[model samples]
Target: MSTGPGADSAPAPTTHDSRSTPEKTPPPGTRAKSSMFSSLKVRNYRLFFAGQVVSNIGTWMQRIAQDWLVLSLTGSATAVGVTTALQFLPMLLFGLYGGVLVDRLPKRRTLLVTQTSMAVTGVALALLTLSGHVEVWHVYVAAFAVGLATVVDNPARQSFVSEMVGPDQLQNAVSLNSANFQSARLVGPAVAGLMITGVGTGWAFLFNGLSFVAPIAGLLLMRARELHVVQRAPRGKGQLREGLQYVAGRPDLIWPIVLVGFIGTFGFNFPVYLSAFADDVFHAGAGSYSLFNTLMAVGSLVGALLAARRGTARMRVLIAAAVAFGLVELVAAAAPSLWLFALLMAPIGMFGMTVNVTANTSIQMGTDPAMRGRVMALYMMVFLGGSPVGAPIAGWITDAYGVRAGLAVGGAVSAAAAVTIGLFLARVGGLRLSVGWRHGHPTVRFVPRERREELTAAA
Candidate 1:
């Protein structure tokens, strides 16, 4: 079903790298301990997770501080969007090639290089801001630099999960990773708000720069022999084209990527929307912005925990979450009061996290290990790279019409895409819509066409 030698189009048998050394099974006695946090039993994964906990908090802090700084300096939402666009533009332009490089390189060493490069950019920005000589352009440059690093870092980190935890725990491990990120999101913004108000954005930037030490140390501490080694793709021409063709032939992989590309490009422009809402619509300033983000983090953390507990990634869940996420954003756009608006951020975040985690895990689980880096790069590219295309447009709409109009437009586009893609997938999968009352409840679902006919005959 795929162009690559052993690419998988389905979930069940696609978890491990067919070309790699035998996967490391969980330690004896731990096999029966399958639970939400089962992946934590792996020593390498545990260290990686702990290091990310610290680093991710710093990441969130930097994000909040950076957006606020840009908004403060320009007083234009468009400029803030431009900053975001610059940061992700490289991903859009060069992500595919980055994936190829990731396939060939040692994931750990590649991450070290990328992480250090990003740290340098953060420190440079911190110095510029602290010295009181920072310009909007300097922030732009730093953001772009980080983007370059992310081109390689994102795909490498994603593919590395299998190496650390193996296929048995991949789903659980991916979910926990999201949970860890959301947990950091909960703390980082609140702290960034205080720092932005009390000290300054520079300190937040500095903190982010220095936070790399933990992850670097963790990487150094990992036992090399324990890793489940997936063979690196040999350098050869048309490898990029090979990865593309592999995905093209897999309906499961291509459809999800297309769905997320639309959502990410249009629906995920929160930096623009939130800042404008806090400043223009609500007049509450940075504190309210941070509060909105924190509440959203609360919902995201809940969603991630639930996903970890579920221990599976289903396409149905992904589609439902995407629809819910879009609808929530539409509701939030018209919120009449600050508190109401803030309260709505939770569901938006929850559904958004659900869509994100489901797509990520499903794609990883379905892909050939040898081709994972490229596939993930395409996934991340569409998911994150769309920001460059979406952010500026969102900002312009906010400036021209209003935050409500801009947000509603984005939500509408997202919802439409979800419904369209859901139906298309259902049809292609040979399922028919089944909507009616079953027992005491209303049921709306898709079933095999033959099942639908059988049900009709029985009725």
Candidate 2:
């Protein structure tokens, strides 16, 4: 079943006649069957993709600057946690409302407003930091503003992809989006670190502020005539509750969200941990800290590319990736030297991106199209909103137990969550995990004992 981007609306499914299937293969040398990158065929998506790449770099720069600014001011791990919490707390509080707004409005216009707001906020932060009169309060205010914008921006941005590429290219577009983000992660912090060393955090903010121009321009330049507008529903009472109900009814949706919340809340509060490790454990400077993040992004970029190559998005892969990601984090926490820890970050990032891309792709593919905005919004809440709760806990742990212990605790919790969820899914799906060969390749498959018996009988 399909649905539009609001409550109480469903779309008719397009029919495919099995009897009409063609047996003939396509001619060779005719593009050799386009891969996932085919989404770039759309002019609007190309513009949007290009703009987001530039904007994401700036966003990452601001993130680094904000973390550094908070640490410099308070000199407390908990303070950095507080800042992170403030930045993401709004998503926890108002994300559902934000989803509703996205459904009710034209996404292109909404994004324009959000991008403008964020630019203003970045400029405000830059001015404060540059004047030498900025205080912790100013940073808090700016962070809150950014978070507020995110509450609206995230859902719109996510839902907008389908409108750009259409449902046929949704998975490819999503994977590419992950690639875009991780790519920015690779560049942004490294640039911010150099900027911080040469000028100050303020300039990073200014650069980020200027980066908004690319996206704003992209949004303005989008030929609305080219958009594949999803039919939208009129707003109504209990829309938020209705969205919640739709998600609650689908295990495919709920389980991934639950898993993401567990991992995000327990495992993904890296900003706090990275800062603590940099200052307390390694006694390193900001450049080394940025280097650590850049290495992780290297891993993440590879993971994204790998995900893009996959033929299908499967639940088993998501669960396995989550488990692997947790294990990598556990190992990373125990590294004895800064160089060792930095090296360990590669797999940690790779697996983290694996989980992120898999979960995101599965949720988007599985959700009802009408409710896509709300579902993705909830996904974002779990994926990002958990930061508010997790950051402070990680911060406090870093302060109380030392950075290594704090990181170790997070890793342990993440591993435990992955194991628990994997077990639950196996039981519910009546699946037993096994490694085997398929299509002349090594593969993993989950099968019920009865299904195995039936298959053998049929053979």
Model-by-model lDDT, in order? 0.86, 0.80
Predicted structure 1: lDDT = 0.86
List the candidate 1 regions with Cα displacement exceeding 4 Å.
1-34, 64-84, 123-141, 193-203, 279-286, 396-401
Clashes of each: 0, 2
Position 97, candidate 2: lDDT: 89
The sequence of per-residue lDDT tens digits that candidate 1 reaches over residues 1-459 is 111222111112324333343233344224323588989999989999999998999998998899999998889887887887788888889999999998777787788889889888889999999999999999898888898899999999999998888878887899899999889977888789899999999999999999988888777778766777566776778889989998898888898999899889899999889999999999999999979888888899988888887776778889999999899999999999999999999998888888888898888878877788999999998888787779889989999999999999999999999999999999999999998897989999999999999999988
- The collision pairs in model 1 are none
Worst 10 residues of 1 by lDDT: 1-10
Clashing pairs in 2: 3-370, 4-370
Measured by lDDT, the strongest candidate is 1
lDDT of 2: 0.80
